[model samples]
Target chain A: MKSGDYLIVTLAAIMLIALYVNMWSAPQQAGDRVRIVAEGSEPIIAPLDRDHVYRIHGRLGDSVIEIHQGRIHFASSPCPGKQCIHAGWLERDGDFAACLPNGITVTVLGRNPRFDAINF
Target chain B: MMRICHGAVLALAVIGLAACGRNAGEHSYRLFVFGTLVDITTYDAQRERSDRAVQQIEAAMQQIDHDWHAWRPGPFTELNARLAAGETVTLDTVALGQIRRAAQLSATSHDLFNPAIGKLIAVWGFHNDDAPSGPPPTPPQIYALLSARPTMKDLVFGDGNTLRSTNPSLQLDFGGYTKALAIDTAIAILQRHKIHNAIVNIGGDMRTIGRHGLRHWRIGIRHPQQPGAIASIETADDECIFTSGTYERYFEYQGQTYHHLIDPRNGQPARGVLSVTVLHKDPAVAETAAKAILIAGVSQWQYLAREMGVKQVLVIDQNMQFHATAQMASRVKFEITPTPDLNISKTVP
Candidate 1:
């Protein structure tokens, strides 16, 4: 191939690679993020790979959510029922646990969520 | 010519990948009402139209919440008071119609889905917004209410749609029926607003109007004993999926759990079934059948399901065993690992 033609092909390949990286990086990271939505507060999206305890102040009181080894659950919540605590750990994509009385919820976000909704 | 061909292929690839991204027209609105999280998700809808539909749904829900609340001071409470006083009270058109339909359903399910057990539910301390705590109502308390046998049949309709109860103990709490009614109403509003592809999810019970773009609306059924889903299923358009689980509302009494789903025959929390899910064209029917079948327990659930004309039914028993009808078995993709014990029953003919 001529030098000019080789340069054109190389430039095209680099452009395609850059475009692919720019477009796909966000969603790949997004699939590992867990979203915590509390009423009257902005939703907090954090990485699932990192283990952390998040304190969200909801309507009733503080709800303590913990992420450990790619799974999340309500460690402690001030709601009367404690159904949130009983919900145990949520690991899979589209898995969710909500403290309804406390007005807080934790849901695993992914590039392609497996289900539109969950029925209990 | 080769360079031009390469450029064309690259352009096509970029466009195709961009198109694979999530639909731009999809919208999800979340609200907390009716004592749980309500999610309204619309696909391929204009933002303005979706907003209007959601606003209308919120307004309708507020109206229903005010009118149908059993514990609060509202129209429904007033109706209960007048009924208890033995007065032939004239009910509003909507309430009257719903009560009439509930009565028919109650008779068909043999009163398993009785709304006339409001007094019993109140005594169990489940009628309030806050969760009930500690020592459940005593045996004497339960027996006294059960002795009255306040069935929906006790409600008698008089002239001008006046309702008088033959048994004054017949208090009305439509807890099992109201959420489903609200869902049906929300779907209607969405349809009116020209939003065809949508899902109306009130808490865990929901109804879908159309597909999620190319595929059907798929959902996960929550595991009664554990976190995550026990199964996932694809829901067809205009299908109502309702699940009644003992874990929804409950009180721990001396280490024993007492849930809010009172079995009309015994006046205590229903036992032997952890959850029951039903799929039907009518949300009311689906919800009512779910509650009825759960109360019917392991031995009698199939009988009630057959009577209610519900073909797709899934029941998780207290033992953690899964029982499903043939229709449900065919569609439900069990997600539980180690392959839990699943017993698929014959189709309800």
Candidate 2:
């Protein structure tokens, strides 16, 4: 309980805090799943799988669409200019994916539904 | 007891601080240059070797730039200016040798990897730092400038530094292959300098000279759409990895995107693919593979990779999906978290 001992403890605490912050702030971990649903359609469902990474290929109408796992998002599409793809990834619930070209809206539903059938 | 506690704390603090200062044994350097190689190596001897190699490369770049740039060479600055004037310039032995090798590869790639795109690039206003502010050029304007532009075949070489152009409008630009060529040239330089192990990253075009001690060079392929996101990391022994993507240098107007990678099929920017990374034994091959894959677009990429017999490649499409050749998947040693969605389908074989 000496004053010098208090100083040492405080220094060690600060160092630990700094280390924790550095580790915590280091980039987002990769397992977060992002879902995309095509608007007006029967809810086009795509889920990003952790075991297998998905690649979004080609354009959806005017919007560039990416599907990974079971999730889908707009990568970049050539609608009028290509404003949607430039908007980047949407991983959170309630995030809306829009493709002006096809009038497709991909919304991320909070819950991911399990598939009853597997299609080749 | 109090003294013991203070001593323990001091010892622990010293250990922690020492750990912070500990060198990883491997080092990296990043250089941003319009032209010239930015060689990064682990050892001091290798660094010196890279320095010498870059010196020669800069000299070679200057030689080619002088032959093509609009500043001097006056009227000769035009594409095929030398041929039009009927002047045959004697190239140095190194230039002649490199050009011969590059020309042969250019021929093989069906001019898909043309070093002669200099004239076309200049016409597109990319050579200038301050590009002309206006709408993109019309098709007619593009055609007028590039219609009669020279092909790689126009370049003819003879004994000594002597080079001739069969066409009067053929301009020689080495920008496309120069960096990759520099990697090869620098490796050669390092070999001559007796330095064995190094890594040369000329603006993301990476080449590993030799292994650093027991460890191989591990390079990460950056995701095209996401900045600071690594698509995959691969280990290499002595090979090189070259990547060309639409994201590199691009400007958006209204809604259209204009990037640096111009499709030779059309004078406009290439679309569909976000990025293309090529793994090859030589930097030059990697460079060509990167360019060819981008030009071929997404659907044709697998076909092209198979035809070219390139074992390793990573292509990210506009949809933000990742596609890799079997070779690329095998080479990957690590993946960053939130690994981008990847599509792994067999190339027709």
Candidate 3:
């Protein structure tokens, strides 16, 4: 094959691969960070790109939070049921989980948040 | 051309990697316990630890429900039986503590918030899970009950956790206040475990501790006559928000519906009030005040609120008008703009 033909083939393959990733392999890149909030406290916005773990002192004691590769989840919590931890990873715009006993909640926000707040 | 192809491949890879992740925020969990929704939200980051914490909290709540359930064959039920049989019964610490607190509340509310009217509740078919087939008891039957007038004062509490009742007709029923006590106990448990921020919502009522980040906990007060929430309030730290509505429990008979909240004085459903919501730091007080104020009816509800020293309150009357205390008017942030019927003046209502 000619060099030009080779070049065209390679570029086409690369473009197809990129399209494939966007369509199927990758989850939506919409949400940028996870917002951590506890009652009567300041919000902690954690970057998805920066891999780190936070020890948050909520009303319920310590909630261990982990952020890695644009995903966030509870690593440990003071609540007895561990439901927040079991909720798995939150990686969507406006996705949220809360340990009501601990009085802390995690919500995902992109450039926009889905809800101002849930009523009732 | 080769250079261009290489550049394109590199750019493609960059785009793919850029799309690699998703987003998340505040963590929340919900459980159906105590026959109502127990919704919890937390900001804790550790997944495993959070799960453990939630499981533990749920377990404690279930235990509380089991021990104190009025219809269940548990500790509280046994205590009731012993009291009915005129036996000098020794109550566990939990039951005894509740009795002591209830004694004080009953006295303060002048027995308008009495828990010793279990038979009256049963006569209204509120004690059972099934719906009532017919109308409420006849006037003569209710009159028979009124002759007994079993007040909290009739119950004797002595040393050694022993309890005896002077009135045979008196029966203890904690339905009016058990949920509030449950919330208070759950918060205490969470606080003891070092959870500084938490909310325990049972059925529709709730108690919150600490803050939800920069803001206080926002709770919605359900409308009795309508679908969506009628009003929203920001909960103060360690505050209890309780609402009692005739809408909560009712049975239809002929063309009318009879609610479970019978006025102790009339031996019938409290009239002139549709619902009452109370916001206070003490869950026990809020629960008692909500019931007492509802029984006091519209014109007299303000007196009960003043006597209880409750600052924030909302009362809905039979006329479909809402009355809010000055403190409530200042504190509540309505989800929807107020209409004409939602009047703010207590005196006007």
For residues B168-201, what per-residue lDDT tens digits would candidate 2 score against the true structure? Answer: 6666666557676656765676567666666766
Look at candidate 3 and tell me the lDDT of residue B315: 87
> Least lDDT summed over 10 consecutive residues: which range in candidate 3 chain B?
B17-26
What lDDT would each prediction earn against the true structure?
0.86, 0.59, 0.74
**Where does the lowest 10-residue lDDT sum fall in candidate 1 chain A?**
A22-31
Residue B145 of candidate 2: its Cα lDDT?
A: 55
Off by over 4 Å in 2: A1-120, B1-24, B27-39, B44-80, B84-86, B130-134, B159-161, B212-214, B333-341
TM-score of chain A of each: 0.75, 0.43, 0.67
What's the C-alpha lDDT at position A117 in model 1?
91
| Tens digit of per-residue lDDT, candidate 3, span A27-109 | 45434877787765767877677889988887659999888888888999977557578667877655666666666778677
Off by over 4 Å in 1: A1-26, B1-24
Residue A97 Cα positional deviation in candidate 2, in Å, after optimal superposition: 28
Residue-wise C-alpha lDDT for candidate 3, range B109-183, written one tens digit per residue: 778888988888888877764345557899998988888999899989889988999888888888848777777
What DockQ values do the models have? 0.46, 0.03, 0.05
Model 1 C-alpha lDDT per residue in residues B44-147, reported as the tens digit of each score:
88777888889899989989988889899988899898998888988778779999999999988999999999999999999877678957888999899999
Of the candidates numbered 1 and 2, which has the greater lDDT value?
1
